[model samples]
Target: MSHTANKDALAQGTHHLIIDGIEQYYHVMGEGPVCIVHSGGPGVRWDYLRMPLIEAFLKLIYLEPIGTGASGRLADPRGYTLARYTRHVDALIDHLAVGTVYFLGHSHGGFVGLRYALDHLQRLSGLILYDTSPTTGPEFGQSIEEALQRFAARHSIRPEVPKLLAAVRRVFAAEAQAAATDEDATRELQQIFPVYFADYWGREREFAPLRESVWAWSDPLRGQEPEPYDVRGELGRIAARTLVLAGQEDAICVPSWAQVLHAGLPVSQLVVLPHSGHFGHLEEPHAFASAVRNFVS
Candidate 1:
């Protein structure tokens, strides 16, 4: 099919493309410059990353990364890696026939976006590193442990705090993840959903529906985990303008990480949402949308 025809089909609704002998799924919304969004979890459904406000100014293509949602799962679950994810993004951009589009990656998706920007710089007009870091493993793990302690301390009096902490712990437990069904993962995600927001309990009326609806899938890693990621030295190489976004109270991807990204990237800006945690897009939609629009425009 022609490039124009391909773009038209993408904007209409859900679409799939055969990439690397597997089905790759994506959805499109809005009507301007193409901005491909990659969601977090490495296994979370893409629905959570939908940016209606940003969509108002830029055509948003939400990618269902390989091994997530209805996208094809790997023959060897260990086969899911940043390299493979980057390749898929490259393929999707090529398939779209939209030259030099914007790229936004959240959480684990941000990891993929970083690698993609480094490896495929020419294809991106801009990069949005939303609630992500340049490295993971020991440093990232330590940060999470510390953040959780703070989160626990902050809500110590709340009866549900202990339960939420336990659920978060189980969610990260290797065995639990390996054995988790969609229902199990989704339940755990819902249980610990409050930690992802700065004030989930305070704003329960507004956020309850999303908290109840969010879902996740465990990464199918049968002892083949990706190598510890660190790209601080390589940040200088990426010339594409970047927007490093973080939430003030984000327990996982902390603000320090965003600071590192902002400091390292040669041409980049950082925006910290005061009233948000990990999910700033949902926590502060208008602010998130404005930052994105101004940067892209």
Candidate 2:
């Protein structure tokens, strides 16, 4: 669809539902077959995926689970367990009166979506997994720790928040100054680029909200112990048509996990995008949207 057409098609709505005494926030847009898009982090804001996927699906439902985004934070970390997350999704579906929906999940959201398929098979029309795994092993956890350590080391050289904010301001200021010199560059750099970058950077800033909310719900579980969440056994029981999409460059979830998920689902198809990473939808929007549209259709 054209940009204007898509913009005109968008409709926004919100609903508050309580699950286990914790209020969760959910947003609905467009109108058609229901498709619920889950965020990557157990705590990531749903807004991160809103523009790309919501525009494509049009009739999409973006859910911010309890203790995430606009949702109320939970005091107990025990309530943030996988089982409880699954129950929250069920409650949202019940509240929406949606008998069945196409469940689209990314990263951590993919794990929650997998659990939903296992526990409530009858409620799903189809399943779309983007860079997610059914179960995470010890090696996976170790790899993540290593990556985070590397990231910390890289950012440690900088002066922290002020430095980062200064950099953003400098770039935007440069663009604005350039726009003052030439009308074309003004429109391209100042008007276009700044708006895009601001929106993108704003989403990154929202990660703090995500982390804090999840911490609120999961703090009590910290330093306690790690428990196994095995969804491998239940994979074969999933009856919904499944679409597994993976990015070739995704280091975290890895492409192999998508292959494993495809192998496990009784009726499923797998598509691996080239030159793409964990955020395949953002990295390759046309291909990602086309793959999902074709599979779900």
Candidate 3:
């Protein structure tokens, strides 16, 4: 289906939370048990994945972490520690008065979700990991450094809004086109790219106020430093039921990471979606949403 069609498939709503003196943004839709969706990067906004699945979910909550998107940027980089982030989740839950919730994290968000489970397992009904890793392996650490360097270089250029939007459109279109050949694939690529691109640009605009802190938080990682986390030792401590999903073609967070995550979580199931990449939710929305509904139910 086209991106528009996919979006049309979703029922959405908006809400906000104030935690640690920052206005944390979130979108809420559906009703039942609450399910909070966390973004992959500490910097990525939550809009990319907030959609009709909310209709199927009891409730879907999308949060933009502090120092990114609509949340206030902290002058102190030390304030960006992982523990502080987990606390942000805590604050949001408390602010919303949500007694219990299902935690869904993509990429880095997955790590954060697991960390939350470690500390607040009683608050979670289950855990959903999308294209995420339990820990950053040696090879993954090197890759993260490379990616940070690339982001640093891009930050230096500081491309204008138009240029950034155009670039996003071109890159996603090229990738989607390269990945699928069927007419349905082409139509979906054309439709979804713009919607995703628009959401990305919306985040870019919302992110303008916090560019400095965002860049600062990302700068050190460009150099040789151990990755920010080592959660492998603590995975088994996660007491919540977990479902792990990996894209068949995700080069960044490879499928093996999902396998590793599954092995660590005693109550976890793994699913690998064929012909999909890092953004499996977008690549296979129906399947993605179905898997989530099944597990969440």
Best by TM-score: 1
Residue 22 CA displacement from its true place in model 1, Å: 0.7
Where does model 1 exceed 4 Å of error? 1-5, 173-177, 219-226
lDDT for every model? 0.85, 0.64, 0.63
Query: What TM-score goes with each of the models?
Result: 0.93, 0.69, 0.68
lDDT (tens digit, per residue) of candidate 2 on 125-204: 99999888877666555544453343334445444534443433443341333222223322232222211121223355
Candidate number of the best lDDT: 1
**Candidates 1 and 3: which is better by lDDT?**
1
Clashing pairs in 3: 3-192, 10-52, 11-52, 31-58
Higher TM-score: candidate 2 or 3?
Answer: 2
Per-residue lDDT tens digits for candidate 1, residues 214-254, read 87766633325356689988999989999999998999798
RMSD of each: 2.1, 12.4, 12.6
Error of 1 at 93 (Å): 0.5
